[model samples]
Target: MATDGHGGLIQPRKVPNPVRESQSHRELHRELLFSHSRGILPRHRAELPRVLESRRLRQLREELQGPPSDLEQQLRKCHQRLEEAAAGPDPGPRPEFLLVRDSLRKMKLAEPGAWQT
Candidate 1:
């Protein structure tokens, strides 16, 4: 069983590395810019008219770069997890039982027939 800094058997959460995340986003943007310049739009990239593409590029240039959108961030996190899972030891038989048991033990519900509708 795995132990944490607190000496508990609970599994430790995987933390995303900011350096790796920034590298991933940089690569994505570089690829998009290359594709745009070459007029080679991959199916996954959103289709845009030439005018819109120019506008988007300008907007991208102007905006003070901030964190990625939620969906993009989520995809990055999932990719990180997949890479780690592929390279690391298999987590056989996850301790789902412990989770369920803990949840049930703390279960709380409103009174029956609390709603008349």
Candidate 2:
């Protein structure tokens, strides 16, 4: 991560010397930025957008901006998981589930049961 002149953490940048960064470190940085932009150093939030809008993020964004292959794969996995969840049976009963049930009952019987049910 780079820092602004005021010592605030800025968005992660491509290492000025790429040779100094390991592949794992680069991958980790990419994931951190992509997954949770807010989770980055708290101070970075203020500096990030400015840096991103500036030539710095633009240059790096152009070079390393495409969705990482890992993210694409994870997204696919998430879709698959959602599909599975939708297709699968509910795991079990939940009490809060009855809140909506009760609301619908009230709506259906609004005239007589509005206050009773």
Candidate 3:
């Protein structure tokens, strides 16, 4: 028995059985993907924000022989998408659409004359 934070005799935490843990993780991944495909998982609820951030960061790190353009706008759009996702309920199914939109926005920003008013 493990003592609780309050000094109570809390039940011993069961160590995760390796096989069970693996199976459970796989199940969870599958469920996440399913929910995303079904549009049940909102963009903010899913991993889109993290993925977009990572991509944007990577792009920023790449050497640009030309001018420093579109990066700020792209980042801003990513931030907006994240905010929108956070503001809305889980968009079950079609989470990919959010990702696609983010990608397109980034690409557009990358293109010359694409970031016009």
Candidate 4:
């Protein structure tokens, strides 16, 4: 029940977190990502349908996959804090971070939506 200082109620904030998902694209085969860096793969080469049907597994895989990038270094930085050198503590992250976060909110958490489109 927070107020806006004028008797008006304050609405919930919708800003995206500073932990923006990686934003690089790598048209590489899933074999390279393995079950750690990029994300988890089908156990024993299980079919796509099996992986898709399992909602829990799908979510786990996506988390492990990190973010889409052609380079391993970028992937490693995916979920990490944004590196804005001059940003300092005054302004924190840049404005672009918010845009990146908004796009993520519209995406399916466990699905391959980052590089798909």
TM-score of each: 0.24, 0.29, 0.21, 0.15
**Candidate 4 or 1, higher TM-score:** 1
TM-score of 1: 0.24
Q: How accurate is candidate 3 locally (lDDT)?
A: 0.79
Q: Which pairs clash inside model 1?
A: none
Alpha-carbon error at 105 in model 1, in Å?
46
For candidate 4, what is the TM-score?
0.15
Please state every model's RMSD to the true fold in angstroms: 26.1, 18.0, 24.4, 30.3
Q: For residues 17-87, could you state the per-residue lDDT of candidate 2 as single tens digits?
A: 75537798888778778757556564556775766668776788767867668877899899999999999
Per-residue lDDT tens digits of candidate 4, residues 47-110? 8667677887878888999865677667667535455534447655569978798778767565
List the candidates ranked by TM-score, beginning with the highest: 2, 1, 3, 4
Name the better of 2 and 4 by TM-score.
Answer: 2
Write one digit per residue (lDDT tens) for candidate 1, span 13-112: 8998787579788899899899989987776555566668889887897586666789988999999999998999957765999878877655534433
TM-score of 3: 0.21
Single out the weakest 10-residue window by summed lDDT for candidate 2. Answer: 35-44
TM-score top scorer: 2
Q: Give the local distance difference test score of model 4.
A: 0.63
Better of 3 and 4 by lDDT: 3
